[model samples]
Target: MARPRTPLLSPDRIRDAALTLIDAQGLAALSMRRLADTLGVQPSSLYSHYATKDEVLDAVANRVVREVDTSGFARGWRDGLLIWARSYHSVLVAHPNCAPVIASGTQRREQFLEMANSVHGGLVGAGWPARRATEISGAVKYLVIGAASTPFGSGFADDVQVYLDRYPHLSQAHRLRHEANRIDHDSFELGLTSLIRGLEPGPGQTE
Candidate 1:
């Protein structure tokens, strides 16, 4: 004989469960029924919290982003940009399955907007013009998303190597030395620093 099961389910709980499922099985595997079953709740119960699967996805993305520790950004603009970029990169890499959904549906969440505003404010306060700050932020974000989403498979790697082999000059200039090309979380900080340094005002320049 089997015993009955019960578990309390709220919006946050559902979202956490969904995140765990996505992390384990990829984003395509997530569905209301699956989440409900995991939580021991009826499928209809999810609708009481999230109107649609997209809503649940939005919540998941927000949850991932919220895991980033933005407190260290209080130092200054340079430190702020480094922290923001690395934080985003870390969070996205942690949930590779959610990256595509995040790239697509990020705008649907208010927390996304709030994070953007906070970055913008920090950049603006650091002496960057509003337009430049916004542009740079957007560029850095797209770069991170683009890099993270790059497919890693035997076929893709072989194709890339073959293409590079054909271009002698390009191949020489862009060597794929494993040690040199390897970039962990700290590597992103170097890129952020370089970009910010290039954007910084020269000596005697006004804000």
Candidate 2:
């Protein structure tokens, strides 16, 4: 058979296979043996591409982080922050199983580091003090991480009686689980807006 234009195995294919496995079976399912099986190759093949599971995970994380948009920084710091947070949240929500790895810091991943540099640089370029700029980055990261940690609405039980008896205030809470997506999204929007709005520049600073 003629050699295929695309190689049977490559970093991209490995990363994608890892992602699919994690998405279906959670992060623990990722391993050289399992990944090789998924790719229809020998475990040794994966070793040639990635030295260890962590290396593969880092690559997978970089791939996901690459999808987050950093172009909003050009619009303005506030808009950039909002856009970045929303985009990050959307990506995490789409890949809940992989969110932990992505949020676990860049781990020397160039793409993730580049994204971090843009956010910080945009803030400083917008006249934010260096310390404050760092703080803002940390804050937004925490917010996005928290929001993606667990779906908010899903925390509530689907049974109306769960809240109706003693906690009258939460009478409608039971319905929230069914509307998890909408509620979680709206809640994130509210939190992101509130957080960003509170970041007014200090004296000698620019908004």
Candidate 3:
């Protein structure tokens, strides 16, 4: 058999496989050995493409960050930020397993840093002071991360009695999980809109 001209491993392939493993089995399930098994390659092969598991996870984070749409800034800070928040939330929701890595807030990954830079720049360019711009960026990040941290409605017990007996205020809480999808989405939108509005500049507000 002629040796295949191309190596079986590549960065893209490694990143994609890593993400798939994380998405299904979660971050803890990712190991060089398991990844090799998943890829049907020797463990050493992964080392050639990635120095360590952390590097592979970083690649996955980059992939996620790259999907966020920062172009909304062209419209203006408010609109751009709302779009950015929604986009970030949507991406995190789709890859809930990756939330920890994405929300770590300590990444120096290229795409993540670029996303941060775009937000800060947009705010500053729109007249927010540098200090306030940083705060806004971080605040918005926290909001999105919190919203995507878990399924809000699903957190409640499904049994109506669970709330009714001890928590009269939560009589309808049991139904929340049944409508987790819509409730979580609508709740995120409500929070996002309110947060953005609150962050909006006021009359005579200046640095």
Candidate 4:
């Protein structure tokens, strides 16, 4: 007689497999059949969990977002925003293949909205008006996503130098920096700090 099949598959497991595939082979390589093959299951079994590829992609995006630990940022608004941005950026950079999926998916998940509301509440408590708080949060998110999407390869510096050589003004700016020493994290910190500073109230302001 044939051996009985294992019942280890779940929505979470399927999503995990999908994320792994994305990290290893890029999002374009993710398909129901492909995922099933990776999981050692029948392709049709995935439909019982995720209805379509789009749904799978959405789950993958959510998985990436879920990787961000908000506990460390719960202390204050500014600190929370910075922590979230850095954490999110790190996750996206580590999984660049899934970055595009994250960029396109709508953050409609309850957990996601709860996190947003928590951040928004912090800003509101810190003397920011409701509408302005929302706008500032949106701006920070845009900056984080934009920065995470930047492409940096092993040859990126050489390529950038070559391009700058064609533009005298750019070359001048590039020459000021020590190309042998890179501080990408410092650059991210500066940008994040500047953005937070821009959101601060000037002079006397009322809540």
Candidate 5:
């Protein structure tokens, strides 16, 4: 039999296996041993590819980031930011398990940082100061990750009665705009656009 161009002992395979495990059950379910078992190899053998589980997870984190469509880069910076934000939200919704792991610094990998840097660099090059660019980039990143990390039922009053009776304002708001209260995908983009609009620099604004 011919060997596949990509060999079995490859970063891709290891990272995929780890990601599958994490995405399926949760990150805690994926130990080195579990990953090795899934790969049909011994745990010690995996050490050659990933010295520790964290290394494997870091690779997986980057793999998830790879799914993001940065093609918005060619469309101009604002479009780029929206595209990146939407891509991020899509990826996280597909793999909710990875959001917290990515956000929590359990494996502080460089791919995400590099992505952030690209946004910040574009903004700065477009006349925003480095400090303001960083803020905008950070805020955009937070908007996606923070929204993704929030559990579905979270932020709402756990006690339904409290949400309805005591919090009349909250109840009315929910009743008035049920769609907005739903945490739907459009909500994220709406918030992202608003953030961009708020931070849009004035005529030739800079530090």
Candidate 6:
């Protein structure tokens, strides 16, 4: 061939390969040697692009956030929050295994900052005071991430009937799952709505 379209060990390509490995094998299985072997390149070549595994993991973590559409915030703060929450949920659900990477907070600096700025700006523009905006954004981040990482089962499935009998409240909730095989979007939306609604200003509150 005359010339390759791109470098054999570019950062983007490296992150993509690493992500695929992570998605299939879990984070513990990753290593420079393993990635290089998978990429058909020398392990040293990987160092030229990423000096350590953490850098690669950061890229993979940020990749999930990079997929979210922050532009939804432009519509208005409440709608913006809802849209961003939905986008975040979609990405994490698709790559549940990668949740810890993002949860660890070792994201690529630039992308994370850009995302934070957009959320803060959107809220301020929509009439939230600065401090409150920061707090609300933080709460929303945790809620969305928590929802994403929540296990599908209540951990009572092994003896669900017995457990349900003891916990009347849980029994009421368990009845709803009979109609579904997995966590449904309606449940998430209900929580999301209640959360955003709670953030609404109360009497005597003025920004």
Model 3 C-alpha lDDT per residue in residues 82-115, reported as the tens digit of each score: 9999999999988988988887736589998999
Model 5, position 141: C-alpha lDDT score: 84
Each prediction's Cα lDDT score?
0.73, 0.83, 0.83, 0.73, 0.75, 0.77
Candidate 3: where are CA atoms >4 Å away?
A: 1-5, 153-163, 200-207
Most accurate candidate by TM-score? 3
Give the poorly placed runs of model 2, Cα more than 4 Å off. 1-7, 153-171, 202-207
Model 6 steric clash total: 0
Looking at model 1, report the run of 10 residues with the lowest lDDT sum. 151-160
Model 6, stretches more than 4 Å misplaced? 1-7, 153-181, 202-207
lDDT (10s digit) by residue, model 6, range 1-207: 333588777899999999899888977878888999999888878888887888888888877688887888677788888888888878887787788787777434567778888888888877788898888889888877877666454343655687676787877667655543255456677778899888756213322
Model 2 agreement with the true structure over 19-130: per-residue lDDT tens digits: 9999899888887889889888888878778888888899888888899987897888889999999998999888888877877755489887888898999888888888
TM-score of each candidate? 0.76, 0.86, 0.87, 0.79, 0.77, 0.80
The clash tally of candidate 2 reads 0
- Give residue 41's error in model 1 in angstroms: 2.9
Error of 5 at 64 (Å): 0.9
Assess candidate 6 and give its TM-score to the true structure: 0.80
Which digits, one per residue and each the tens of the lDDT, describe model 4 over residues 1-207?
133386657889999899999999887898888999998888888787888888888877777787775554456666777787788778877888887777766778655676677767767776677898788778877876766665333224644567675777766546645542244456667788998888656323532
